[model samples]
Target chain A: MAVQEAKRANRLKSGKLVNKLVNEYWEDLINAKKTGKKVVYTTGLPIGPFMAAQDMAWIHGEGYGARVAARHEEKEPQTFAENKGFNRELCSYARTQMGCAMFAELGVPDDLNPGPIATEIPAPDAIVTCYPGCSTGPQWDWAIERVFGKKIPWFNVVIPYHMGRNGSTYMKGEEFEENVKYVVRQFEDLIKFLEVVSGKPYNWDKFQELMGVTKKVGKLRMEAMELCKAKPAPASFFDWSIQIAPVNYLTAWPGTVEAMQAVKDEVQERLDNGVSAVPNEKYRIFWEGIMNWNKLGWMADKFASYDATVVAGRYTHMAFWHEPDTIDPEHPLRGIAINHLECQLNLGYPITEERMMTLSKDYSIDGIVFHGARTCRSFSRSHFLLAENLNKKMGIQSTSFEGDMVDDSFYKEELVNTRIEALIESLEAQKSRG
Target chain B: MTSKSDRSSFYTMGVDSGSLTGKAVIIDGNRQIVSHSVKQLGFVSQKAVMMAIDDALEKAGLALEDITYTVSTGYGRKRLEIAGKNLTEISCHAKGANYLYPEVKTVIDIGGQDSKVIAVDPSGNVKNFAMNDKCAAGTGQFLEVLARALDVELTEIGALSLQSDADIKISSMCTTFAESEVISLVAEGHTTVDILSGMHKAISGRMKGLVGRVGMQQPVMMTGGGAKNIGLVKALEKTLGVSIFIPDEPQIIGALGAALFANDFATGIRKKVEEEQDLDKSRVPAKDCASCSVQNFQLNKN
Candidate 1:
């Protein structure tokens, strides 16, 4: 059979992809129901599924979507209502994710969207949660229960953190295979639950085809990262990082492999041409913290003009690193689980720091710039001390900049520019003296 | 062997067991350094201290019996059993700063895992201080990571940052994000010089934030291993709009402070011992004196 027909036939057998597509298609159907029109919901990290559901829901008018996030305050609020029922000791990412969920259920006014938006978004008619190990996970479960009551459909995907980071002791060189198997099992369970809830037979062949396509796409994506390992790959860490969205969202879909194949071809062409991602290459810097979501273009342009390049960052690497080289048919679900768990943000601080140091050494960074986000205490909490230590111990120059990833108002370009100018002069002087 | 008074009057030893390195300083009473040694800390703190002490003694042309008193400071100050007294790193740093430049009012010490901004009175007393010990963002470790990211030697960071012609503003405060930003910039074809400059700016900004909290006072003295980075020093001066004074051998300030304390302690001990001897002589009874004389005669006869 031709690749397309083979994919179609395979999708028909698995039923997972068909189930997701039907779920998305069912958003419109659910919105048509008077009782389910104003749906509200909450979600956790590896937010691609939730986002996809939201996008689909918006198309179907299954009610407008709003993501709940946590705010950082010096003092914990006195009451549960005031505190939003969150643990102050938890990381900011967990706090925010949980806080958003809490606010949604309690009908608190949020800056993301004032008043009530949707009681629940329908794309994810049922949640397929992986782990409740992090503080955010349990709170997220509680928040969902509080908001939707017991009426909402949910499935748990038990992801042991030890298995994710430490790899499986039960298997060597087959850890990824084991992890993927677990994911496939969860996917199957999710499909079964959806069929029962929707009262429709999921097309198994389409699902298998989708999974097959995803497997192929996963392979190609790994190839893309490997391509970067080449001497003259035509990409930066940022390029590779941003490209992860399609890989994550479109995975297990028929179109993913083709899309990734095209990207790989382009990357190969660039590599053949011996083209570097950044042409000017004036000064190379290492970045820390979350990217400014709104001003990435602006920031990139500003730095590019100065002939300065950002060599590495946590966000970009999270997407590119730790990809499996080949797919395991026997353990497809396990692969998905490993992919989700291995993200940079999901790892603990010690591991993150070790990776950062390794990247710094590997990249030959001149200096480090730490972005201390106002909102993300999880990522920004100890950055100042990290910078100080780097400077003192390694004889490297380190500095911190304050701003939020999503919020643009916190960034003052004029103040930032002045500081940059002075810093450059200082660097120049040091070079001359040396 | 030298008499206790002679030993006390002649020499003193200072040990500073910093987080990353250990230093030992041997000085004569008259402000002349007999010898000094530095060693990077291994897993064992005591071993590092012993090695440093042995090396300093070997270099100083002195024996252990010749040393009167030893003062210790830095993170491992309390672990030094051979030292007579332990002083806080802050106090020792200030003393060292004063010894190098008596006019310095502000002292900045950047260590491996922490950075401190210290304000000193004319008498070298610490008046106020601010410290960032919670993260490695503005510390030496950040630089080490950046150096690795750039594939450059740690010592080359300062020189490279200084060579940049244009300023690259790295806006990430988190080390992870900052590294990502660097990678992105490199992909976009940014020059290493600009990136280095951006990094220097970032460090300067963090230092300025801490310095601003303490209020910048002149003459500012930059100490610690971080002070070796001229780019950082210049960046700090620019950020604070003030000149920074870097003394010779900036890393030795803490040990220098310990040495000064040792000198004072040794002198005080000598005075106390002399006073005790005088008291003992005064309290001598007549019968005891006769008996002592007889014993001395017998000893002489023997």
Candidate 2:
């Protein structure tokens, strides 16, 4: 009973609130679709603020896949796609959403009825592809078109890859400034496309208000992040990740700001009292990549067993730390341009290496855990190299374990358990000698 | 181990309840192996563990209470209530390999359920390691699956694969695909020796990749049951471009490591007594590691 009470005290209320907000947002979309309102499909980039300002529901690709998996309704769509000859080795998020698309369009069998993301997410009236040259967003858009038997209205804003050491390192330079101008021009095209689909002109005033909200959330989130630098961090990265739900799904909304503020307050209280989320926090670890969402509790418990807490990570804090570019207040699209391009997913190394080293020092991390989430190639590919760099530079050791974001079978619990236990044991030995 | 005068004799038992087999080793006070036993692990892990322990005790001429300490390891380490401590197979394998071949900086262990490569520093501490238990590829189960596909006993495969003259390329990384390819090779009139050699090459190539992940070091030692397979060892040496050192009783390495740990714990010479893992099923009081300081990362003002 006491343990249950402690868990409840440690838990954040924003998760329930975010779930409510998501359901209501989806219900609003379902109702809007009935009234002939268009839904804009997106690749779940940094386009949430823009979509919300246009009053078009964002049926984000990866977000929908996560939703289908979180709700355990992925089997129907995943099987449907495999039967239709889609390669199983493709990214899991892609496979799941494709399954969701085919299942939603054609029909689900009697025994395979799934929840909203799989069955009720209506066909996209338009697609907004935004992965620059780093990935293959165009290929996915073409596949979606092939599956749906129609060419949806396509609006793409190519986020420029970082020619410098950082993704947004050259934002202040003339070349990157011109690149931002080019992307801002494409945003103008997206605005025109939205104007055609929603049958309404661009609303600059509403977008300005949304950007103001974005600024507010960023402030609150960074404040909470600062609190995590405390010794024996007030909250684990797992807790921070749960709090990021509102920021990722309902970005630019007033509710998101409130959720973030509440999280900041809760974290501040823990910091003021010098209270750790885990009872006997020993090692401060920088978790470098995405966790297996389904095994979050299992992994957290294992870390607790080792008396370690993940202090900070890219996956948990990326959405929160996205401070919009210092562009003119009149040009809101330029801020979106900066947000889309500055993301770690859209960038390569050299920059990430520096950021990880700094955060490792700031968090006073003793070790690291880089998960190979099989579904995300963008995150998994650079892990070993990044880990090697950190080890050579900072003496911060890292170990890799394979897992999937939502697919439970792909995640071998024993394998992960043994590997992690071995890592922790090794760290303990090293620390003992040091 | 520290000095001649301080050295005293004590007995300890270590049991490794592996997935496919159970191994037990008893060490005297001089840290010499007195007796050991290896048995196939049947359905019940606890029974198999006790049977192996009894076999070792008979050879050592000792009863249960005669041993000073007992440690358990391997896949079923947690199940044996007779032991007061348990360690992961990684630590045990490293310890065992280090004891036998101290010059070895790397240990590649291919057990029944999983495989791993441990890179050890000069101090006999693991510097880095990589493991693969996600799939049957490059594991003992992979060999067993192929053995069944070829209608051959597992014990004979090592000898059979060495007689082949020409190398047959087997490109499938998936076990199921590999099995089907093996069947087709047999149907196409390929000799069992050649097919077996191809399978050994495939397994070694996969293991070589795992070893390379931890940055393969020289003087590599091979432990676990897989090291007994001559064909696989040759293939691994060929793939890794270096010969490996294998212990006499390759399968009992984990058990031997546990016994060494048990002796050290009893003598209070090595790791301080602490509640490490899920042992002490008697629900004994937890003892935190004394050498460990539970605190934040101290500011390194370099």
Off by over 4 Å in 2: A1-16, A34-36, A80-87, A113-118, A132-149, A163-182, A318-321, A325-329, B1-10, B41-50, B65-68, B184-190, B268-302
Tens digits of per-residue lDDT, candidate 1, B109-207, equal: 886655778777676665545565244677776777777888888787888788887878989856777889888888889987778788889988888
* lDDT (CA) per prediction: 0.58, 0.75
**Which residue window of length 10 is worst by lDDT in model 2 chain A?**
A1-10
What local lDDT does model 1 show for residue A165? 43
Give the per-residue lDDT of model 2 (tens digit) for B186-226.
99999999999999998898887777667788999998879
Candidate 1 steric clashes? 136
Candidate achieving the largest lDDT: 2
Supply every candidate's count of residue pairs whose N, Cα or C atoms clash at under 3 angstroms. Answer: 136, 1
Give each model a TM-score: 0.45, 0.86
- In terms of lDDT, the poorest run of 10 residues in model 1 chain B is B293-302
Clashes of 2: 1
Query: Which pairs of residues collide in model 2?
Result: B10-B29
Q: List A-chain TM-scores for all predictions.
A: 0.61, 0.91
